[model samples]
Target: MDNVISVRDLRVLDGKKTLVGPVTFELAPGTTTGLCGPSGAGKSTVLRALVDLLPHGLTRDGHLEVQGRPIRYGKGDSGLRSKVVLVPQTPVVFGGSILDNAVFGLRHLVRASREDLRGRVEQALKEAGLWKEVHNRLDTPAQSLSAGQRQRLCLARALALEPAALLLDEPTSALDERSRDTVEESVAALRGSRTVLLVSHDPAQVERLCCRTVRLEHPETMALTSTAA
Candidate 1:
């Protein structure tokens, strides 16, 4: 099978300075691959670069391909992003009920009837492992959910788009142990079905969740190592 996403000599630059990478990797279809490294190794930045969400004034250089199409640099291509969604390190919840949050991204990207949209949201919630808890209370304020649920809700929102790949940036970084476990289980369930690129600073977490890993080193070294987990 073809790779879902591919990066070759990808690097992020701040003015003339290289802030990240000279890293490369391929995300195989239906597999969970970890992008793991120490703090300041630019794991999260790599995720942003893939989706064309790099911060202002920063630019990415090198080849990026989604499915098999080459992505042009310096373009904020909405279509590219829609196919490869990024769920940030911090889960962001907007003002609304649980149902509203789940359908946030889909409402804009998809032109479908209310029933169809609801059906997709329902399926995404189940994929995120949040349906059982929120199905009956979808109308309730999303803020009522705990920290981990909020994160999974963000995941559900992204999943509703039916993106070709998911870029998760330190998904469990902000949760308590129990909440972290819950999120891990949700991610574990995605393996072999959903293409995932998980950015994690926690080696143990990567070990438990990823089939293989791409390790990023500091900019000074400009080296990346790939190994099976």
Candidate 2:
């Protein structure tokens, strides 16, 4: 299968000190790959690096490509990010109705008529496993949703972009068991259709959701980093 994203010798540095990477991995099309490691292993940092969203004062070095195209640090990062959506650990909902939140990013990124946009949002909602619950309440305030529902709402918002790949950062970590199950079901549904890179501390969750796994660790006196599957 073709890879949606590939990284070779990727690393983040803070004024000459290695903070993350010197590791490599590939996300294949339509496959869910789990990124797991102990705390402080830079799992989240790796995700940000993929999209060129590395924090201030952190610089990346390596070969990074998306859909076979090289991703320069500042050049076209926004475009690359739009194509590969990232859903952070915390769900962020802007002030608007549920429908507004779902269509927020879409309106700026996708050019379509109102009717067409609505159609796309509806499909995305269903894909994110949120359609049935919010179908009639789309006009309602988005802030009214519970934590679980808000997370799903965020998922739907990302799905609306019809991205080539998804970078999920601890997607179920903030939810209760029941809510986690629901989110897991939604992710499982994307297995054969969407390429996903899931970051999680829970071995069981990774085992359940990922077809392959990449383990990252602190380099600790090593000159190079390696990834294991």
Candidate 3:
């Protein structure tokens, strides 16, 4: 498998709290990797460190790469961040129409043609299992939608950017059973095409979507493969 991301002895420290282990893992293209750890174990931080979104002077060590390219650290690499979108635990739906929220940042940060935008947006919404529920409500304010809808909307928003990799922090944690199923389906479909790193406490969910699993015990500990577990 072609590797898209690699973390070698990655260390991330924020003041006195170390957020990442000397993590060493490689993400092969088109495979899904599930990240599991105790709360505050820095599963999210590992991803953020890769994208350089940690607090200023957080201090990151070791080598990281993405899509065969070094994950360029430092400032002014906004474009790189776009290629590796991170969807947090909370759903972030803006106050505007759902369509606007989905395509809002894309218009300014993304440079796709008008035709491409329409197709990709529709595809993402459909893939996210939101198209049927939102087909006629594209112009409706996202606030009018239910919380579950908003969560799916965020997933759609991330998918709209055409990211090569997606970092998800419990993407289904805030949803109901139905909404959770939608997220699971979306993840199942996403695994073989995009490099996905998901931090999930749900073991069943991890087994459903992940090809491999890694558990981070503490900041100084090593990333242990759970595929053998």
Candidate 4:
């Protein structure tokens, strides 16, 4: 199969100042790839650039493609984001039941019947390693879930879309050690079935979860390096 995502000479800029990249990499189908570097190395920034979610006033430049079609800087709209779903470092749960949170994107992006959407949500929750814990209480308030559960819930939400690739930005940074382990298990389960680009400051975590890694140099150096795990 072809690469799920391809990026080359990508850069994020604020006016004339270069904030991130000139980085390049590819995510093959069903592989877990890590993006890792020290703080301020623009690891998170690169993920944002990939999904065209850079903060206001910042812009991206370079070659990006999903399934081989080029994505222009400003052309990465809802359609692009749907294919390459981004799960931010912080988990965001809307006001509703757990099932509601999981099916949020599907309700907007897919024109499926309620039963079909429910089935997809169930599958997503399972893939995220969250179904066993919450399947019985899907109608309960989502805010009641613990931090790690909330994070997995967010992952389930992204998974429900059946995205071409998933961009995870420091998904475990905010969780406690135990929670981190749980989330890692969930990520590990995705290895051979999902295309994931994980951003992490913890090298050990990257080593544990990713098959290979892309290392970003300090902002001053502006270099992107890669190695197989």
Relative to the true structure, how large is the alpha-carbon lDDT of every model? 0.90, 0.87, 0.81, 0.91
Tell me the deviation in Å of residue 39 in model 4. 0.6
> Candidate 2's residue-wise lDDT over 1-229, tens digit each?
6689888888889989989877888888888998888899999998998877888999888898889988876565667768888999999999989999999989998889999989989999999999999999899999999888888889998998989899999998999999999999999899989999999999888888888888888743222222332
Q: Which residue pairs in candidate 2 collide?
A: none
What local lDDT does model 3 show for residue 197?
A: 90
In model 1, what is the error at residue 23, expressed in angstroms?
A: 1.0
Estimate, for each residue in 97-149, the C-alpha lDDT of model 3 and write its tens digit: 98888886588787788787877788889877889998988898899988777
Location of the lowest summed lDDT over 10 successive residues in candidate 2? 220-229
On lDDT, the stronger of 1 and 2 is: 1
- Window of ten residues with lowest summed lDDT in model 4: 220-229
Q: Candidate 4 at 182: error in angstroms?
A: 0.6
User: How far does residue 220 in candidate 1 sit from its true spot (Å)?
Assistant: 6.4
Per-residue accuracy of model 4 over 149-194 as CA lDDT, tens digit each: 9999999999999999999999999999999999999999998999
TM-scores, all candidates, are 0.96, 0.94, 0.90, 0.95
Q: Given candidate 1, what's the lDDT at residue 47?
A: 91
Candidate 4 lDDT score at position 163: 96
